[model samples]
Target: MESSMKKPAPDQHDFHFWTDEKFRIADTDLNGHINNNAVGQFYEAGRGEIISSVLGPPAKRSIGAALARVQIDYLAEAHYPGMARIGSRIARLGTSSITIAQAIFVEGRCIGMAESVIVFLDKATRKPTPMPDAVRDGFTLLG
Candidate 1:
């Protein structure tokens, strides 16, 4: 029997944060396709940009955010020597946590999608801390 799962499609307008990245030769595996780890890095790049835009640069902040969980679905294989557009948006927000939805597209094809949960925490205590009003408001604007 064939699986009933459906693959995700590329929809850039559905996300608020957008960026484009080029795949390097090193990003490919021996099979000449982009490696899963490279795809993960693309997702990380999107998450980092969103977090920085909302919460300020990590170097200047005493508090920091950490990834609580990340789930990625690989929809299609991607080759190197190409560019990809990555989109990220806030899926949910809590007092000290936020869930981000991300998609990677190459030539208008959805190659991967990911959902990540990040928790804001105090650097010193390493425990969850309420997000600042400014940061929360910034995230709200993106949604």
Candidate 2:
């Protein structure tokens, strides 16, 4: 559980960014295709970038916080030695948590998509905390 809350369905409009990632040899699996885990990793990169931008610093654990949920959908296949472009957007921003949606595209086609809900918490008590103003400011929609 990520504290008490409700989350609406995620939509296309939730995406707000794009990131480019180069595939490495280790990123491939025995099948000679990019591992499924790579897709989620790219999504996480995008989320970290956005969170850092909003917080005026690099993204971290935010004291006692941690990733709460991750839902991924694989659409197509990704080959090795290719480029992965990741796109991201905020779907939900709650009092103590935020939901982000991300998509992985290779060779101009979507290969995967993921949604993650991350929570903020008090470092000492490990309880949910209000999203700091600095962090919320990065979400233009809420302004």
Most TM-score-accurate candidate: 1
79-121, model 1: which lDDT tens digit per residue?
A: 9799989999998989999999999989988888998999999
Per-model C-alpha lDDT, please? 0.89, 0.74
How close is every model to the real structure, measured as TM-score? 0.92, 0.79
Q: Which candidate is the best by lDDT?
A: 1
Candidate 2 residue lDDT tens string, 1-143: 57565344334344557789999888888998888777778888877776665654533545445689998877778887889888787778898888877877787677788888988788778898998786676665522
Minimum summed lDDT over a 10-residue window in model 1 is located at 2-11
- Displacement of residue 15 (Cα, Å) in model 1 is 1.2
Off by over 4 Å in 2: 1-14, 58-64, 141-143
Q: What residue pairs are clashing in model 1?
A: none
| Candidate 1 residue 100 C-alpha distance from true site, Å | 0.4
lDDT of 1: 0.89
Clashing pairs in 2: 14-89, 15-89, 16-88, 16-89
| Backbone clash total, candidate 2 | 4
